[model samples]
Target chain A: MSPSDSLAATGEDQLVSLLTQNLPQSARTLHGPGDDCAVLQNHDSSSLTLFKTDCLVAGIHFTMDTDPARVGAKALNRTISDIAAMGGQPSEALVTLALPPDLPLSWPLGLYKGLRNAARRSHTGIAGGETSSLPKGAPPVISIALLGSVAPPHLVLRSTGQPSHIIAVTGRLGGSLAGHHLDFKPRLAEAQWLAAHGPPSAMMDLSDGLAKDLPRLAAASRTGWHLLPDSIRRHRRCSIHQALSDGEDYELLATFPPDLWPDLSAAWRLQFPKVPLTAIGTLTNPDIKSPPLSGGWDHFS
Target chain B: MSPSDSLAATGEDQLVSLLTQNLPQSARTLHGPGDDCAVLQNHDSSSLTLFKTDCLVAGIHFTMDTDPARVGAKALNRTISDIAAMGGQPSEALVTLALPPDLPLSWPLGLYKGLRNAARRSHTGIAGGETSSLPKGAPPVISIALLGSVAPPHLVLRSTGQPSHIIAVTGRLGGSLAGHHLDFKPRLAEAQWLAAHGPPSAMMDLSDGLAKDLPRLAAASRTGWHLLPDSIRRHRRCSIHQALSDGEDYELLATFPPDLWPDLSAAWRLQFPKVPLTAIGTLTNPDIKSPPLSGGWDHFS
Candidate 1:
């Protein structure tokens, strides 16, 4: 039964009672369950591995017509991006699918084809997955989990962005809706180069458009940012809303120092020419004069 | 928008074309987008870390009358149990939620309470999660992904049951309907203890009922099993169908050296006494002449 029925009966206190009352101190976890990925040290090396998984559903996140391969690519890329945002190299991934009974075998098989195809291209394998069929009316859903590694001391993170840093992005924006959203590759190469070199100040992927997301990096670093509209990619027919609210542009939105701009740009072409790089803004300590922007894609808002 | 609208768009080959042609070799993923859990080794580690995630929807996996906390609990446990079945320890987790619009603000909030509550008990944390609301007609859905560690030099797997090994389970079966299904603990502690100590031969969580699950395990191990009916628990009122077909009993069913029974029981007591332990059956060393069990759970069957 739903929690309300229990609430109507035993009240909320019973809720905790029904849930485990005494959890163990947790012995085997080296870093335990709250982090970008489960942190496990490589006994023989100076680095650690990072892992994560994410899910998106059709109708809930996208329509069925969304390219099956991009859906697969995005699902895989999103998790890999998590590893990248943390400044790690993604080396593996797994996908699980939940389909409605009416779902065509080919639809999910297509999703897998997309998933495996993306995996193979990345030198990733189809580790394996479970395909479950749900009752009618249930939407199509896909979930993927990925694993990657980084040298010990330099995993980049949202909490790492600091005041007085410059915020940077790789690649142009505003045109993701055309066909790029589904086929974008995660910045695994870019992240590896940055990690092996040095921290990029603070970083995150611009999945949700930058207008709203730039501030999150700012907030995570406890800083505020200034963006010149002129520096951002803008389509003639697209409004700032599209730039601010559109999701699925999996490019690296990172922060570094102004002096590092030359190095960042130089590194992008020599190492990652297939993925474009750009400078979108700068970060400063948040203050009364420049309030932080909190206007991203709030699910409810 | 489904592939259903375009007959020309269906087929595994079509999916393969969309996915394979555009994959990049730069990602360095040893395995991606398939397998029970993506297996990867960083130059840093000698062993592999397993990652996975799945979603449970209200009205689909449960009803409105279900405990919101239990719903949250089950969401995490479902995946954790999957890890347990593989004899791994879940070290980190992430969640994504899609809620119904116009529900009491307390709804999602209460669900988070349940989520954190489970995390606390499971020794996991809230980590990171995304929340969004769907226009009406969307059922409340919660998705969770977990990052886990398998001991180096050895990782227990779901597809590696052996012939002639004993199949043992901790806890009674066939009575999840008695309210035990909603809030079961993943045998994380027990499974880890087993992995470190005895090493169950073939393992997996029993979610889709023993009848259906046993064969999958047997097939994975490349063997058949003879069930000792007396070893299985059952409710007097529970039909053979319910005993074999009901889903959502988060118990550990594993096979190992028959001699390890004593040590395994002691470990179970030290780790999961709230749950029972029993030796249920043995795996045949060779293709058996007669099968002890008649059937397994099949949604289509």
Candidate 2:
């Protein structure tokens, strides 16, 4: 078996298509497979019930050369980002570490330190995990299973956008190659804000770059997307490709009703004065003749 | 990683054992790693909570030739056994399946179906699970997590036996190599019965053969055990080794006060006429030594 991206190696489109094709109704699951989190109905929590498992492969996800703490932070951050996409607040986490016997004690401790610190900052608990020592040659694999809860009516998902909904982004893009990927925040507060006030429809995190991830959310919602390329490229001033395809931005992409555009910007600007939420595009009724955002990542094909 | 039994291969035991040697107190957890279930205080629960997790690897635990349904049943039953060891009723289960794409989908479906059947028989809910395909060439692994409940304070555990406790077992043992390993019940009912009525001081399921697992329970309680080899062998008309080590009998093992023995057996006879609860041995406060039951199956070791 390969990562979800690998399925796309046959082509990214096919991977996403296959993911949703055979999904069981999962009635017990208020928000199922397609969303960043699975949701449950709770009057106390309009929040989406976020659940995600992210595995960090030694070679693919990170190398030993990477700082142990940063590696740990990255793992937790990635899972948090998934919950963030659905506007959920993380409540608990489980970290399963599969390490080779040769790894020094300092390594895992560093990783744990990083995880513990981040959990503290996020106000979430690292509930528990399993630790295993693989054979000498086995790669270190760390998998994090996170559970989060979000307010229901405020639960923003990737498949709720519609044609004519304007696309927007929270915070600037690009420059993750400089190591921001390992240091990024989960955008939890921003997501909660969006859910409470504007409550944008069709939301997701920009991890594999907006260019790749945007199209995914768009296609899932079965709507075409239009972007103001100049606006995005102009703000970053970096190579447009970096702004488009460079992954791990950890920003939020959301769609909003045309009438709420001003309030969306005003509210975003008022709250996170420094982190700008910029309008990037509009959703259109998709057709066989058109595609949403842009191409995406594929592993196997 | 090497299996759990391969503790010395990587100098990890110094650390793993160190972390586990003396457990930290948790206000919520009734039983930690030393027992099959990590019992928690569920204030509203009219019953005791029992939780456990077990993992199955492709090459290590089972192979493609093994029936997929059996694999599924094994995963679920292993966890159920954990609860049974605590004299608890099975409540709910969740499965996490990590597969290789090369394997047939039919296998996974069969596993799901079999697991569902097992859960149904246990009268537990299929809470749902997260499924993912691992990186290419990774062995297929299945892990089942279970949640169960027993009458509060009646949940028997490994560390509670007394020196004067009388050892007892339910049902006959041996001949399990005849496919009993693949289709074993958790002995949940017998466990509950003993927990509530027999007044057992300690209880656990005989899974890793009586020899290996019984020692583990004894060690946890810091007690010594004296086995009745003749009595055990006579009951089954099998070799002492077969009676002691031929495992997967899935029998309920418990210890109680000597005076309770007659009533316990009589009650068991009335409640489950087909299964007899008979005395086997007694706990000892002294450094008692008995022959090893037999190292039944520690493949890696």
Best by TM-score: 1
Quality class of the docking in candidate 1, CAPRI style: incorrect
lDDT of each: 0.64, 0.68
Give the per-residue Cα lDDT of candidate 1 at A186.
Answer: 75
For model 1 chain A, the run of ten residues with the poorest summed lDDT:
A6-15
In candidate 1, which residue ranges exceed 4 Å CA deviation? A1-45, A194-199, A235-241, A266-276, A288-296, B1-48, B132-135, B152-155, B158-162, B189-199, B256-276, B285-301
lDDT of 1 by residue, B1-301 (tens): 3555322233322332343444343333443332244444545465556667677767656777776777878888888887776666676676666555545544555666677777777676444544545546656667777766675545676566776678887776676767777777777877777877777766778877887677667866778888776557655677656666676677777888777777777877877667677777788754672344435433322
| Candidate 1 TM-score over all chains jointly | 0.80
TM-score of each: 0.80, 0.75
Quote the chain B TM-score of every prediction: 0.80, 0.88
lDDT of 1 at A161: 71
lDDT assessment of candidate 2: 0.68
